[model samples]
Target: MDGTLTINGPKHTDGLTVERQEKPFHPIEHVDARLISLLDMAADSICLIDDHSRILLFNKASETLFGYSAEDVIGQRVDILMPQKYAEHHDGWIARYLETGEHSIIGIGREVQGQHKDGTTFPFDLSVGVAETENGKQFIGVMRDLRARKEDEQRLRSLQTELNQMTRINAMDEMGATVAHELNQPLTAIILYLQAVERKVSKLADRGPITSEDVEQLSDLCGRAIQEAQRSSSLLQRIRSIIEKKEPERTTCDLVEIIRKAHKLSLVGFSATDVFIDLSAPDDLPPVSVDPVQIEQIFLNLLRNAFQAMREVEQKAIKISLKIVTDEEDRRDRLQVRFQDTGSGIPDSHRKNLFKAFDSERRNGMGLGLAIARSIAQNHGGSLDLAPFDEAQPGACFLLTLPIASSPSDESEPKTESSESMDGSQ
Candidate 1:
């Protein structure tokens, strides 16, 4: 009889007998350990899920990205990491993939929202892969948080907007210069023609025995026409000088007169139904050394700002008062004009940057008015500042000071015979 030899353990005497035994084999143990180590070392989050959509593995990065611990996420459904809308369709997607091997998002990286442990959602880039394991089919996903990238994008957009605004301002400056240059010749011609017409009208009045009343009326009309024409020419010249950045032509001028002109200009299109203005100036105030046109511009800007600030207020009023102030440090006299408004006061937060260019609080403002006004004052050897806030009265006050013209010619120049005190009200 054919017999097989058995190893010496417990011998069977009937014949030579052999015994065999088999041990359980697990192919994925060592490989799985190595894969988990690699996944944990990755910067992006990595998650592994079974065919049932249950999380089989969650790496250290996934824990950090989702603000969840591995112990909390593993064995749970993967939809917990996704937003509600995405989670609702996630199961159907996996089911369809299982049925038809059609890969819609597999291997394609795309942006999606990831829900955090605290219930907040953030953007992330996700790339998914399908694999066949010894146990079953599974999905592997790699995700990268996009919060930093999104912040960088927002910063870039803000910078671009500022650049665009600066570009627009530069273009406007060039256009203003061109317009002023084009307007100069026509404006001069208009003033000259008006003057010639006035002279001719005056000659006619002297030649004929026109009724005294008619002659006086005609002279009055011609004088007014010539005065308006001259005013227009002066306005154009001021614009040209400003656009060309010419140095201001300083002269001795009545501060009260400049204020009156500026106030009139500021109220051109303003409605008086809800607003009142009171202007007071002393007749004994001395002349100031300043660029009259620039000072007028400053006054106009301040008045316009006050009007706009009080547009929504029920009781709106602006009071302008002029007084002579003496500097204690140098014993020098200066003229100060105070503009007080009964409107919304400036907040402490806005006061620091109120005169800074491009830092306006008003929605439709360019934030250049106060800056330009202050610059003009400084150039005139004067200063513009906001007066101290008075809690008792809720409003804003602006004080402008200019050095008094002390030249011998200013003192000897016939004190303007006009001692008319102005108390304008509207």
Candidate 2:
């Protein structure tokens, strides 16, 4: 009788009828009405639940945030206000905390989605604490809606993307004269090839009979003409695609293929025949974790920088090497791309703030390329840096590191949590 809960009416427990003349204490009734009045007036959503996760007290803000009245959820399970994905986790953590006297989320603020009575979910920041009550322990949760903050972040991301596109356009503008000159070379070559083809045809007409040798020569000249035209057309198309503005889309891509494209595109103004580029990478390297177009922009920027640096040098050469590296601090695998140019090395004065924005030494240069590239790299859990100068090596060396994409086999289906919520009698 001493260990049992006292009830005024007869009640059955363990198949035995127990009668008592004592009145059962109501937690909300026993607590000071003034505390309840303060809770009702609080701005943030506040909810109190028992060990079984049943809602004991729900304030005005809680009712408004969850689209439910106090009477509707008073004796209901707390899961009613939680999204399906997080409801089970809420109960599990509570059970574990009570049994093991350990906490996974108690007194710690966490971002979680809350489900409204209309079945819509929204993000909220939750902070939970345990309070000692007359009956036992009750958990109090304070939640703040995050919709406005989330909207602000989304808008910021959009603005950043627009800025990146504009920077790329400005970089192209700086190379306007060079790109035009390069385009003229390919077009002029095509014309010369076509003229040679026409001359061969005229010679064949003058000759009495068309021999196998004559046919072969004409075929070879025509093929060369077609090749020259295709080269000009391809280069134009590549440039056009680069300047075209499009919404950013991300996809996994091969680093070697992107490097090759960027290298070809970057050599537009530079004498391709005079400048030598050597690229080497492992055949079995994993795919790069990056947005193909954004990563291509980075490659283009580094290549163009190297090409410009070697303008005065007699032998313009760039050595690009790629290899896998394991970060010692985190044990994460990354791909490192090295661009070592045989040109006048970076001056010591400009080395410290190399990636800083608007600090260009080159005439008419935007100085944003490296800064943007480094920002993009870091955003993808990677890095971009100028290799420390070595007395033995004369030219500047830029090292870019990127994460390796996870393989298809590494992905697993997401585990869904229970979607149950109970509304029991008060």
Candidate 3:
């Protein structure tokens, strides 16, 4: 008879075996024992199965992998190593495979989840191979755990979320500092003007008929107070909207008025430090459409930076000038304002990236002032540029140029003043 396997005194197509009557050749038993030892000592977990999905052979590595002894696994159904959830459907999978001869995992490698003897499920990468023998077919499977990699990925994702939150908080904090310092001056001015008007009106006798001149003066002061207060309220709203992630509310605005408001705020810091301002502008200027609140923010940032630059100087002064120039070639018009500081000029090396985000040169400063200023300028269809400072007189000049409204008829002309033209500084 041909060589074959026999179990319980019955022939089976499991493996090749010599007839009982014939002498064993080529030390077959020794070879089999060495092969089993090699599989037991393998670094990777190994499992051997027959074509019927039965556990024909399992090494020490496989026993440790599935938390089962070799004796408990051998000759058992493969579903014993699977979790209860998977075991319920494993029999049907085997039956379908046997009938169709289709292979999903055979000769392929993929990722899967596996169960441990302690009722824990973990991720694993698996590779399967098929082996054909003289009497029967078998399969070898290798598996590796992925718990460590999965844990590391989760940690990285959490850190990214935390970093994003911190960035937003820092942005809001910076914006708050700017608004507080810039808006305080104009607010104080408005209050002083209102007080002055009240003092003048109180001088009249009780039930006295107030003159037209008195009423006109009082109305003018009240209107100014209302305008300044409205400006402050609008600025606060803009800052709040930014913190809340809402789009900035933009509308047609007078560019000259926005600059005047910014200058008013900066005057506070200058006065506190005993700095003087020399402001000049054309008699009449055209208005540029933009977000008034954002333009004010731009001016506030620039003025603050300029003031901080000259803080150590004995004579601190700021010069502001506005003009309207039309582009002959392109037929485009622009409103330009120049803010110059009589302070220490920027170093050549630092000037290259002065407006860049996080450009830190001033001591104990956040270095985001110029960056925010430039962003605001750009958002208003305008730009901020650093001009060459005079070497003899140390100072820096920032030029703000905004696009003029295309339809000049849409709005009234902007009011302007010369160096000596503005209302007295109270």
Candidate 4:
């Protein structure tokens, strides 16, 4: 029985069979109908390809898969099933294997691209097996459609994303109390300082010459008061930037200066820690079109989150890195910022909804910070994503991406304007 080919008989130990069906065995022509009867009822798409990757046999399943009747494809080249992009390389693969006896897909099951009757490409998982015979070498491929499985997986991911967003919104609400209190302290201080300064200035102006020293000190105090007012205003701006449902207004701005200011602003509450902000961009990394203030808020939120995650750890450090990246898919430039921390890592359970608004893992925190942070990132035509904090140790890293301007050196440098002295005409 060795080397004897069979259509439906059990495979022998030495690769032989009892009955061979080398040629088409039609029940009407042949004495036996067993082989033809077996062919009519298979559930999977079955096809036979020769050494040159030309279709030799097509079954009922093959017709249903490619929207073609068996008669239309039985003698055609197998490259018709592959998409245009894959067809070129596929011919080379077939020829190479025919000569070298090397097989990448034989006896293997894999996910591959398939072109339908309408020329639409879809995913399919195909399992292929090879058999040798007196007529020629043939490959039998059993294909399973994967569109349904892909859809189900996509639905699950969408639901998970929604749940995470809900959790983050809740976290933000919890943090509201802390944010409000922090903002109020500065506002209240600015009010008291302004009132005191105004009263002192009015009394001194009404009395004597208000000596040069007195006037100079008063001007210094006024500048300090203005700075305090600006601080309070900046806090409100940051909060409103997240909670307000509005799109970012893009403007050309210096990224290096923006990062420096944001880093300085974020350090207000973080004490007892050493942090570093590092920025590198192509000198040609042009002033990107972005909502500068909103970008600042995003950086602040990420920096604050990193600082909080690392605050309790012994290392007590966080780093901010900014760079320009190219998007191969979109064919555009992107402004990328990475906030890396050396702190206690996030628990496995919390990773899925980490960017969700108000989804805070900490009991005392309202999860809104990261959620709002992500919202702002998206509003600016970008995304915020989290990754493993470090390769060697433990921690988490957050990535912020924004669309960059077309080029860096496009603007004409403006002439510096002089400050004019104002007369108190009013």
Candidate 2 lDDT at 335 equals 88
Order the candidates by lDDT, highest first: 2, 1, 3, 4
lDDT of 4: 0.66
All predictions: root-mean-square deviation over Cα?
24.8, 12.6, 17.4, 13.6
RMSD to the native, candidate 3?
17.4
Which residue runs of candidate 4 sit more than 4 Å off their true CA positions? 1-43, 204-426
- Off-target runs (Cα >4 Å) in candidate 1 are 1-244, 272-274, 360-366, 407-426
Candidate 2 C-alpha lDDT tens digits along 1-426: 454464433222233333433323234656688998999899899998886677888999998999999899987889999877677667557655765588878889989999999999999999999988766778999999998899998897787677777887887787789988867876788788778878878887897788899788878877877887788788778776666777656577788889877877776665545677777776566788787777888888887777677778897777788877889899988889988888888888888877887786732252688888897788678999999999988798889999888533333443232221111110
lDDT by residue for model 1 (81-100), tens: 98878875676676557655
Q: Give one digit per residue, the lDDT tens place, for model 3 in 240-346.
A: 54344333467767766776676665454344346666678766556677767567767766776776777788867777788876656676778888888787777
Model 4: lDDT of residue 289: 73
lDDT of 1: 0.72
What lDDT tens digits, residue by residue, belong to model 4 across residues 50-145?
755668777777787888886777667787887977775665555556555888888788998998888888998988888886556677788888
| Candidate 1 Cα RMSD (Å) | 24.8
lDDT of each: 0.72, 0.77, 0.67, 0.66
Give the per-residue Cα lDDT of candidate 3 at 147.
77
User: How high is each candidate's TM-score?
Assistant: 0.43, 0.76, 0.43, 0.51
